[model samples]
Target: MIRTGILNPAVLSLLARVRHTNTVVVADRGFPLWPQIETVDLSLVDDVPTVRQVLDAILPQYVIGRIFAEEEFRQVNSPSVVEALRDHTGAIPLVFEPHVEFKRRVPHAIGLIRTGDSTPYANLILESA
Candidate 1:
């Protein structure tokens, strides 16, 4: 009967469980899987649904306090890609660290959503407000 907003049941369930300061990861298609953390694989094809595309769907429903990403994202991806992501993030503070440190934070996230984005280092961890 529900016909609007986030329609994916798995994604809705995952968002429902998030609390203040809890983290949720939106990773690219190539991001490594963590057996210990729950994941919703939304990947349809290579670059079919980008990480930004998923974020667009979740941003209105989720309260993101901060975003964490790899410093290398800006270095590896085009300037337009970086700017596009920044525009989507709006006022949310974005912090960048080394790739290793970024991965270390993944296990603590409430859940991860894997996207079909092929962009290198396109992964991001959003901490709930």
Candidate 2:
């Protein structure tokens, strides 16, 4: 049995399958579900396991190359969310795209892990390193 890191079997298995350059989305609860892409829904309740919580668990397990966020994230989300994102990402450069364009790219992601964060525009696309 796994003792550390992400204990969720589905999430662990999905992380193992992701390859370099592959895109995985850590999305907020309200993000649209794409039928063509695999979704690992981890949302329990409002702000249960937040986007920061999931990222903290996953970042150590995966080598992320690039992080993408909606252009409106700064405007829509709380300052704490932004600070948490910065704290976790550190040196990783953040790229911002329009929400429409961000949604347009969702179908191309290998998977989306939904979190219970109620913050608007909290979704992020992580490109595997």
| Best prediction by TM-score | 1
Compared with the true structure, what per-residue lDDT tens digits does model 2 show for residues 12-44?
Answer: 888888898998999989988788988999999
Per-candidate TM-scores read 0.98, 0.94
User: Candidate 1 residues 10-63, lDDT tens each?
Assistant: 999999999999999999999998999999999999997899999999999999
Candidate 1, run of 10 with poorest lDDT: 1-10
Candidate 1, after superposition: displacement of residue 46 in Å?
A: 1.0
Candidate 2 backbone clash number: 0
Predicted candidate 2, C-alpha RMSD: 1.2
The stretch of ten residues in a row with the least summed lDDT in candidate 2 is 76-85
